[model samples]
Target: MTTEMSGADILIQALNDQGVEVVFGYPGGAVLPIYDALFNQQRIKHILVRQEGGAAHAAEGYARSTGKPGVVLVTSGPGATNAITGIADAMMDSIPMVVITGQVGTPLIGSDAFQECDTVGITRHVTKHNYLVKDPAKLGDIIHEAFHIATSGRPGPVVIDLPKDVQVATAPYRRTNTSALPHRGYKPAIKGDLTAIEQAIELLSKAERPMIYTGGGIINSGPAASMVLRELVKLTGAPVTSTLMGLGALPASSPQWLGMLGMHGTYEANMAMNQCDVMLCLGARFDDRVTGRLDAFSPHSKKIHVDIDRGSINKIVRVDVPIIGDVGRVLEDMVKLWKAREYQPRDLKPWWNTIKTWRDRNCLAYPASVESGEIVPQHAIRKLWEATHRQQPIITTEVGQHQMWAAQHFDFESPNKWLTSGGLGTMGYGLPAAIGAQLGNPKALVIDIAGEASIQMNIQEMGTATQYRLPVKVFILNNEYMGMVRQWQDLTYGGRYSSSYSDSLPDFVRLAEAYGWKGIRIERPDQLEQGIADMLAHDGPVMVDCMVAKMANCFPMIPSGASHTDMILDPAQVSGVMDDEAKALV
Candidate 1:
């Protein structure tokens, strides 16, 4: 059964064995053989991106949406260099991605050879791990290991640098398929810590006011643990709060949901964290953004940190009970123990009522425009949600005020349903990501809620969506400025408003039209619902330019590096500021 094959063929075979149905990449001289071999492989589809960076981001988007390792293939030198930003973006966000780049032949590695760069060294800091394939025989093993490493242990990008000679070298090929991967430095905790779990349960049973703070780890660990957390909350009657990464884990409208708790979080959620006696931190990190003024953060609460990574426990805030294990496994064990012990806390209705009163008094406040002539960003998101409510669509966003508005206003009913650039805060992320997500779930409705400034970063991907004819609806919140930074300056920095305007902005409708795609512009509020409906009804790619107020700001503001409890409900005052009418003119 031994058959000789080139490194490129082995690589393609490995990918096919891994169930990879698609790849995003660009062709170059060193990588021509790989692309040539890819031509016959009908099982895998290759998406040629306009830029190498777009390829990388598109791969990341595919991975994030599909829960599989996204693969990117690019050439050496400038091609590899162009992909660095996207690699770093994936690394910062902890997304599972594999980047395969062509390198100069082995002999030319250090001879100042043309199109030769130390891609492995350049990407070391960003990737979870990397490899240089000197031997064609080892290509399959390297690819298999890369997928395992990228998808496991917190999930991140992994790189494989392939030399041109190696791609042409011939070797016997054999596919390896298994449930486990061999990595010496990579080991994830899968078993729960029984002693710590029992202690955590005991603490919750004894506490008068208890709350669960969760994060994205819950989503990555899958829905089993998330369900357990919900059941435990219902059984114990403990209020639940989540960070931005953890929003979709608990239903937004649930009675026990206390809203997002951190900077820019609801006042009641922050107050609950400060006032609660016990905080059961599940699959969440004590990020500075979430725990502002750490010295004063949850000062009254006894924190029980449950995380899969041992290092994450006590990395920031100290923990009374540190349980190290997979979030899903730990939650399952805790649930079993709770059922056996039959432990329950007394009535929390009084405490829940108090929290509700605070929430009702000061809901996430946004000014209602009396003019009502133009379409607002919030209204666009609301209508989009309405249009896709029955389908339970997956919403992704680029990083900006529109992203924040979507986070605050969109009611996410399921876990992992909302994908965005959270930790990395990468701009130009939405469009390609939506395309990837649409590819992942062809039957589901996938939309990218993007801003004018952020959308331009990856607008070239419009062709990618069109080529695939992916039914990805792009709702461009065209405010004609970097809305978030501008909002800060207008409020805190004397309204300087430097470099935030796009006076010469391109007409997005026409820009989209240039790509031979359907484009619509919504100027008035009345056109909102119909526009969204029209987009949903269409069969192919479309972009809707939603003209929103340029000066609108994301509310329930928490100033940077400030305590969560010390949030500013209103915009900061500017000295000698003009009245609303006068400010509108500026």
Candidate 2:
């Protein structure tokens, strides 16, 4: 007794089977049938976003925070095109996401029908995988396949283009029960070779200056991976430094912890990477940002790269040991192997001495707020962490100076707490992402630490927060400039300023109020702590606009194309004409 159902019904049912609790999307002409089907569905909830781009980023936020594939539903043409940025961001950072777009009818696709574009063709490059559904009966299987491709292996966004006529047509819904579509071709390696594991351990056992470099792969592998990572770090007593995406994979309070290692990374971490005898790279690609000068990066180290993707190995920096498998599974095996031998902590006293010497520089230290009597952006971020009592809070940030400061100042002690646009560096990603995080964890204190200019990119999503009563806090470091752009001009372009100034900014307090939310403005250092606390304590959405120092720049920067050893440790001054306060606004 097979039941007949529309393509939309099968698609929605498949989503229910996959356990997608919520979807973020915008309604348009082609998607009307699916939206209609969605209205009566009790198993899934849909969040109607103001823009399609917000839908994609919100899904990213949901995926990162929940360890599940964030689902997106949008219409064809501009709606699908708007999601391109997030799709690319997820692909680069490896976040699991499924985007289903309603396309023009199959017959109308080539005819330039209303609200029609090549959704598959345009998104083909950005997505991990894409499908253009030609047959109505295949909708259910395609829906399930999208989830499968999005969440498996190195997770990323997958798109499905559903033609309007097919969505409205009848299907048997055969994919509803136990028989799932077999995907025999996409088996990712989950276990590494025993010999390789043994060899890796031998290197760990003998190395004096061993360091662990990790990235977003550990987080994408789930909390279990982080557990094994902590155990492995403990077993060897080696220094651990994470890339920007790997912040919460290791506890920030551990004695073995060096701060993040990269271009804007802590000096101690970068120096340790440059000098380590053996480097165990786990679940992290050697990104250009992390490797300042590829040839010079970790020149003294014999590197072991452990990643699930075999293609990622030796793609940038050649590795001495390449172990391809799921990071969690590999880490579990390593921990078990080490415990079987009853290994004691390695002798790291000398290594610790050198690290301590570098830490003595206090490279991460910004001017004291009380000393400067000014609200530096880093100081504000440090205060934000302090106000939260250094607890693991769900923190998201837009790209640029605020993102780096959030990464540097906030100490994340657990996985899945720090979310940001890591690889693509998308602006306007924070606020919507925070909304998704809040949606995932209703009771958690979710904050989007955004810069003033970047927040405007998807600022319209504030209404969504208010409508849902999500209790999201948008904490703006209102430096009145695009700080990173200004930093570059000061460093490379003779400080010309060149259209970086973000002038004619709106009154954020009024804007929040207009969106039916609470708003607070903090203009001085003394007002910050309480202001942030107030925003978090509010039962509903609140946006706090903190007036930050306009001229402040993020330091410990690896200048473009320079080695990690050659860092701009302090603010570079521009003499004569461009020295005025007006010249360097971002």
Candidate 3:
């Protein structure tokens, strides 16, 4: 049954029918009608964020954590502009999200009216699909289509621009459940070609040195895909390595697990990737960070790539076999075909033995905080893991050294447990992501492992947590500098120390108090564990400022444009103006 309703009411009804439980947004004059519709809604809780960008990120966090397309609502002009960063971040990382923004009424739209800009034009490139609803009857259909496209195939952000006049205009509201969304232009491949799947299996069966290289797509495919991946790994007896975003796709404790692979990947993981004779590429695209010096990478390997998006195939390095399908389905077929054929893997014992030798390098080994009085950021992350005693504690991270350290030290045993800005490397990602994760899994212990400089980018999110009485914890590794930037300047730029230092930083403890939360500061290694414990034990939001070793650098780094073999393995090799070690080197 169709009913005549205002466009604003129709949007709310569409949201209710789509099972939208919450919306993170900031209101402005242009979106007054939508806000009026949302004002007294009980079915969908509205979270008022401090900034429009924060709303988009929080929505992304909710989607990545819950595997549901996140929804964001904002007003025109500046509100829409502020959200571009999050939209681009989601688009790059393939996080599914729908952002709805208000535009000036149809008559005012091209006249440069108050708070009017080209909302559609500004977001068109950043979104997978965008709609500027000119017709009243098309509003609900466009919203439904936006959701479908945003969550379908290689999931990404979608934008819907609602004109103020349209909101007041009457439209016929129809339930999306009864009517299928009309989308003829976009059809994504879901099942792989049978011939290609068989060919990939045969290629894997014959290869002696096989390694699985996967990325965020596996995580995005949900737990079922992760299970199938495990089955395939078990059947083949091959080693598994993942991109930074693919951390929790397989158990970190699994025997075949090589820690995260790529720029800051473990030595064993990168070494195995370079030496593999058959690269079984999974849901991951060969990102530049993962594939350094592409020509030199696995030069001897016959690469078999399986991805749902056909465009990603042969887009970077060409593959010997390309299988287009959902990773879960392809992996299931691979496992079934292997069983049906009674296939035996080519003896990979020699390859495993070589990987064991690389593991002996102890690439991740770092001194304990007790050995050095100063708190090591690595040790602090390790302590957080111990304090949680979790194989998969939901963790979000801001981009930088802390992000890498969290990936290395924490054991994410399943998908959706780890969330961070991988492709775009957004600085202010973690806090809002943590908030969204907390809302998604209300009972889970959600923490944002952040660097001081990066965390400050979205520190305002603390208000959102406190207001909602969420127990999300913000664990800051305070180095008083943009650690990664400083590390690069120290290494590549001859330690010029150009503006990298974060001087006169705010008093985090007092800042947390100002925002209505508990705050703890730990400067010494001995105080670190207790600080985290107390922060975790607290029932509400808590911020921990752990002043870590000032000069410590994240290691096992594949220097930019360098081959996997050319990594500067540890902090000892790094020299700086303030370092006595540099003086000794001179």
Global lDDT of each model? 0.83, 0.89, 0.89
Error of 3 at 584 (Å): 30
Residues 500-531, candidate 2: write the lDDT tens digits: 89999999999999999899999888888789
TM-score of 1: 0.94
What's the C-alpha lDDT at position 94 in model 1?
Answer: 73
lDDT of 3: 0.89
**Per-residue lDDT tens digits of candidate 3, residues 469-556?**
9889999999988999988888766878889999889999999999999999998988877898899889999999999988788889
Q: Which TM-score value belongs to model 3?
A: 0.97
**lDDT of residue 378 for candidate 2:** 91
lDDT of 1 by residue, 1-586 (tens): 5988999999999999889988999999889889999997798999888888888888877876667888999999999998988899888667889899999999889887989899999999988889999999889888998888888767789999999999999998877654555676677778777998999999898888898998888877777767887888778889899987787788887888878877667888888998899999988888876887677788888999988778788998999999887787888888888889998787787888888877885757665533447666777788788878778888889987898888878888777677888777888888888877888788888889998889888899898887888878889899888998788677656778899886677888898889877888887788887888888888887889999887777767656545667766765422324345433422
lDDT for model 1 comes to: 0.83
* Candidate that beats the other on TM-score, 1 or 3, i.e. the better one: 3
lDDT leaderboard ranking: 3, 2, 1
